[model samples]
Target: MNVSLNEVEATAKRAARGAGYPWGLAEEVGKATRWLCAHGIDGTNSLAQLLEQGLAASLKNHRPVEMQSAWAGQGVLCPIITGALLSDRSDLLHAGPIRIQKLAVPVFLLPFVASAARAQNIVITHTCDLFRAATDGDRLEAGQDWPSFSDHTQITLGGQLTTPRPHVTRATPDPACWDTLNRFAHRTYAPATEESRLLGAGAGLSDND
Candidate 1:
């Protein structure tokens, strides 16, 4: 079904939180997912897939580890965590391109990179295999071959900006993906109880007035 970007963000936030991510990270996921959808990427499915993996395995395994010239994890890296770290230490971009190996859902990292670029007032380029993407804080351009998952990727601080892609106000998420997100988001709801349900009413179970 067609939905507004705001709807996507809210649902993504709740889903992330319900999937065991801290509120702060969930908030990040919300913004990132919205950004992706606006740019015509399938962020809902990516987030749903990530949440499924997180629920099925230890998130610690996805934590990034520094290597000689790149970062790697025991398993595929979670883009949300990695993206936050990049935003936190955006200055690292000054040294050189940040290379991350075995990154899951690399597209989700774009918003974080774009945010960092806007903050630093610079252009950034992200590449994996044949896929290429670049953002200059305001505008973004990516190859049509953007992959669902990337085994290895590199991000650089400076690059030539491409023509901006028009953003949409609405997104039509895949039905299966939307259902998965709802399942995760549902975990945040509290079970209904009799007292809670009757709290707002002036009378109890039996109301004659």
Candidate 2:
């Protein structure tokens, strides 16, 4: 189904919630999808892939993100949780750049870096396309020197102290992107039971005159 970009974000948010992400992280995913869509990148497909593959389990179990190791048991780090930790303890970046042994869906990881740039009042950089975000959240600076997210299994990310103002741009996502998210979103709705349906919204009212 073709949907507005706003609807795309809202549905992904609800689906993420139903899929067991905490409300806060779900909210982040929503905004992230919208931002990516505006950039002409399909973050919805990346999010759906993560859910279908049950990647949240890897995230839920891997807390207290550290620099010395890969996620325990799972070979890759969950970006939502890892991103949260990275943002929360951003001071750790002062020591040096950190590396992830393997990261699933690199596109999903960029939003947090953008947010960190805004929150910390500095420029933030990440693995995907080597994009850098400004502190005002007004720009994403990138050059053609970087590779696509699909080409990498792991990456290094860090921050720079510079901040610059640049023109902003956003575009509507393709219809195919909306369809991809709906495939997983359909699984999130609860099946209505007989009793619940009888008492559910507008259940007791009828139009008969």
Candidate 3:
């Protein structure tokens, strides 16, 4: 069934939170998912797969660490965390390309790259064996081979502009994927109690002013 971008973002945020991410990161996840869905990508499925794979268990272990000339994670890197870092440190992109190893759900990184690109007023190109894409915060272009994950990822600033693409207002997620997301999101709700139910979703059941 088709859902509005707002619903997608809200569900994604709650799902991320329920999957053990803090509110701040979950908010980012929501925006990223909305961006992907708007651009014709299966973002809910990607996030569902990531969460289902137990990647969300210990996020700290997946953080990217700087080595001699590149960043490597102790385990596979969480794209949302790494992507947030990329947006936070966008200025470093000017010095040289940033190479990240063992990144999971690499497509999730595109939204953050777009944010970085918009901040720096330049188009950013992300290249790897699985995919090649360029974004300028608004326009986006990705290869047909863009996979769900990548072993190594590299991103460089200042690429040629891509054609403006129309964005969608509603997204049609896979039914199974939507159910998976909803299950995760269900954790965020407080259990309904008799007392609360009597209150009828407001301060009281009374209609009197």
Which 10-residue span in candidate 3 carries the lowest summed lDDT? 142-151
Candidate 2 structure lDDT: 0.58
Model 3: per-residue lDDT, tens digit, 1-209? 89999999999999999998889999999999999889888788888987786667898888887644887878988999999999999998989999988888888899999999999999999987757889999888874336767877898987775464567889999999999999999999999898879777676667777
Give the poorly placed runs of model 2, Cα more than 4 Å off: 61-65, 69-73, 128-136, 143-177, 199-209
**Model 3, position 154: C-alpha lDDT score:** 91
Winner by lDDT: 3
> Alpha carbon lDDT of residue 82, candidate 3?
90
lDDT of 2 by residue, 10-44 (tens): 87887777667778988888887776655555667
For candidate 3, the lDDT comes to: 0.86
Q: Provide the clash count, candidate 1.
A: 0
TM-score of each: 0.91, 0.70, 0.91
For each candidate in the order shown, give its overall lDDT on alpha carbons: 0.85, 0.58, 0.86
